[model samples]
Target: MKEEKKPYFPMFVDLSEKNVVVVGAGTIAKRRIRSLIEFTNHLSVIAPEVNNELLELETAGKIEIRRKNYDREDLYDADLVIAATNDHQLNNDIYSFCKCMGILVNVCSDKNKCDFYFPGLARHENVVVGVTASGSDHKKARAVVEKIRTIL
Candidate 1:
C-alpha cells in the first residue's frame, strides 16, 4: 500500500521584517525573489550568476546580493530560506541543515524535500489569498488562484 503525502497547512507568516535568504538567481529564484521583496527588505540572494533585475534591487537597497556559491553559514541568520537552485544535492543539503536548525525552508525542485510549498498567491490590496494543490498539480493551483482573482 502506498502512503499519501500530507497536505500543506495554510498559514500567513510575517516575513515583513525577517531575514529571508534565497539560494539561487535562476528563473524560479527570480520569481520567488520578486514576490518576497514586496514583503521583506532583508532579502539576500546568494548565487554565482545573478541577473540584472536582482542587481538592480541590490543597487536600490531592496536586497543584498552575494555573488558566490552558497555556504552553510548563510543559513545561520536566515529566518526563512528558499532553495531554488539547479542542484538537487545542494537543495537537499540545505533542507537537512534547516531541519536540524529548526528554520523554515522551501525546496523548489522536489516536494518531498520541501519543508514548505510555495503557493500561488493573489493579492488584492489588503486581501491576499494562496492556492495550492498539495504539490500534486501546479496548473490546477494556478488556475484556482486566477479564478479567485477574477471574482475578488
Candidate 2:
C-alpha cells in the first residue's frame, strides 16, 4: 500500500489588501473569483478571453482584468494565487512558480501539486465554516459546507 504523500492542514487566511490573481475566467475560475472578490478588491484575472460575468466585474471596477495568457512575471508580487486555468500544463507551471516563490497557491486541476486546497466554505454572520476532504472528495466537502450553512 502507498501512503498519502500530502497532508492537508486547513486554516483561514486574511486576503484583505492582498494581491490575488486568478489565472482563468472559466466556470471554476469564476466561482473561485467570486469568493475572493468578497475579501479583496485588489483581485486580478488573467486569461486569453473572459466570460460575460468576469467582464462585468471588470467593468464595475471590482477587479483588475488582463485579457491575455498567463505570464510568469504576474507571480512576482502575488500574495496568493489560484491556478484555475483549463490547461493542465499551465496550471502546473503556475503551481511550480508559486512553490518556488514561497507564495500560497491553490491548483484547481492537480491537488497533489497544490500548496493548499481551497475548501468549501460557508460564511454566516461572523462565523465561517470551511470543510475539506483532503482533495479526496470535494463533493463531500461542499455537501458538509452546505449543511453548515443551514445550521448557522
Candidate 3:
C-alpha cells in the first residue's frame, strides 16, 4: 500500500524582524526581495552586482546589500533563504546548504528543490487565497488564482 502525501496549505507567516537572505540580485532575485520587504524589515541581499532597484533600496537603508558572491557564512543567522540566481547549479547548491543547516529555503528555478513553495495569491481585506499545484503545474495554479481573483 502506498502512503498518502500530506496536503500543504497557505499559511500566514509572521516575518517581522526575521532574518531573511536573498541569494542574487538579478531580475528574479529582485522580485523576491520586493515581496520579502513587505514581511520583514530585517532582510539582506547577497550578490556580486545589483540592479538599480536593489541599489535604490540599499541606499534607502530598507535592506542590507552585500555586494559579493554567495558565501557559506552568509547563510548564518538567516531564518529563511531564497535562491533566485539564474544559475541552476548555484541555486541547487544554496538549497542543499540550507537543508543541511536546517534552514527553510525557496528555489526559484525548480520547485522540487525547495523546502517551501510560494503560490499565486489573491487578497481580500485580511483574507488571502493561495493556489499551488504541488510542483506539478504552475500554469494550473495561475489559472486557479485567476478564478479566485474573479470571485474575490
Candidate 4:
C-alpha cells in the first residue's frame, strides 16, 4: 500500500513587517534572498562571505548582512528563516531550532526538513505566479515557471 504525501498549500504571505533571516549567503541563499527582498524590507543574511549581488543589496540598505559564521542566537528574533548552508548538519540544526521556536523555515537542500518550499516565481507589472513540483522535479518546475514568465 502506498500512502500519499500531503501537498504544500500555496499562499501569498505579507512579509512587509516580518523579520526574515537567511543563514548562508551562497548560491541557494542568494537566490532566495533576492526574491525575499522584493516582498520585505526586514531581510537579513548571515554568512562568513557573500557574493557581489548580495553585497550590492546591502550597500543599497535594502538588506542587512552579518558577515560572519551563523550562530543559533542569530535566529532568536526571526519571524521566518531560510537555511541554505552547504553544511547539512547546520541546516538540520537550524530546522530543529525553528521547529521548536514555531518559526517558519525553508531548508534549501533537504525538502523533508523544510517548513515551506521556495517556489519558482514569475512576476509582471502587477501579477505574480509561483510554481513548484513538490520537491519531486526542480527542472520541470523551473521550466513551467519560465513558460509562465513568458506568458506574463
Candidate 1 lDDT, tens digit per residue, 1-152? 99986788998888888999999999999999988987887899999888789889999999999889999998899999999999999999999999999999999987667767778988888798989998788999999999999988
Per-model TM-score on C-alpha atoms: 0.90, 0.87, 0.82, 0.92
Candidate 1 structure, TM-score to reference = 0.90
Cα misplacement distance, residue 77 of candidate 1 (Å) = 0.6
What ranges in model 2 sit over 4 Å off? Answer: 1-7
Compared to the true structure, candidate 4 yields what TM-score?
A: 0.92
Clashes of each: 0, 0, 0, 0
Question: 2 or 4: which has the higher lDDT?
Answer: 4
Relative to the unseen true structure, what is the C-alpha lDDT of residue 108 in candidate 2, on a scale of 0 to 100? 85
lDDT of every model, 2 decimals: 0.90, 0.86, 0.86, 0.91
Q: Report how far off residue 35 is in candidate 2 (Å).
A: 1.8
In model 3, the runs with Cα more than 4 Å from the true position are 1-7, 124-126, 147-152
Ranking of all candidate structures by their TM-score, best first: 4, 1, 2, 3
lDDT score, residue 6, model 4? 69
lDDT of 3 by residue, 1-152 (tens): 99986666667788888899999888778878876786788899999888888889988888999989999899989999999998889998899899999999999888678778777877777677778887677898899999998999
* lDDT (tens digit, per residue) of candidate 2 on 1-152: 99856647777778788999999988999989988887886999999888788888989989898878899998898999999988999998998899899998988877667666667878976687778887687788888998999998
- Cα RMSD for predicted model 4: 1.4
The residue-level lDDT of candidate 3 at 56 comes to: 90
Clash pairs detected, candidate 2 = none
**Candidate 3 structure lDDT:** 0.86
- Candidate maximizing TM-score: 4
Pull out the clashing pairs in model 1.
none
Instruction: State in Å the error of residue 81, model 2.
Output: 1.4
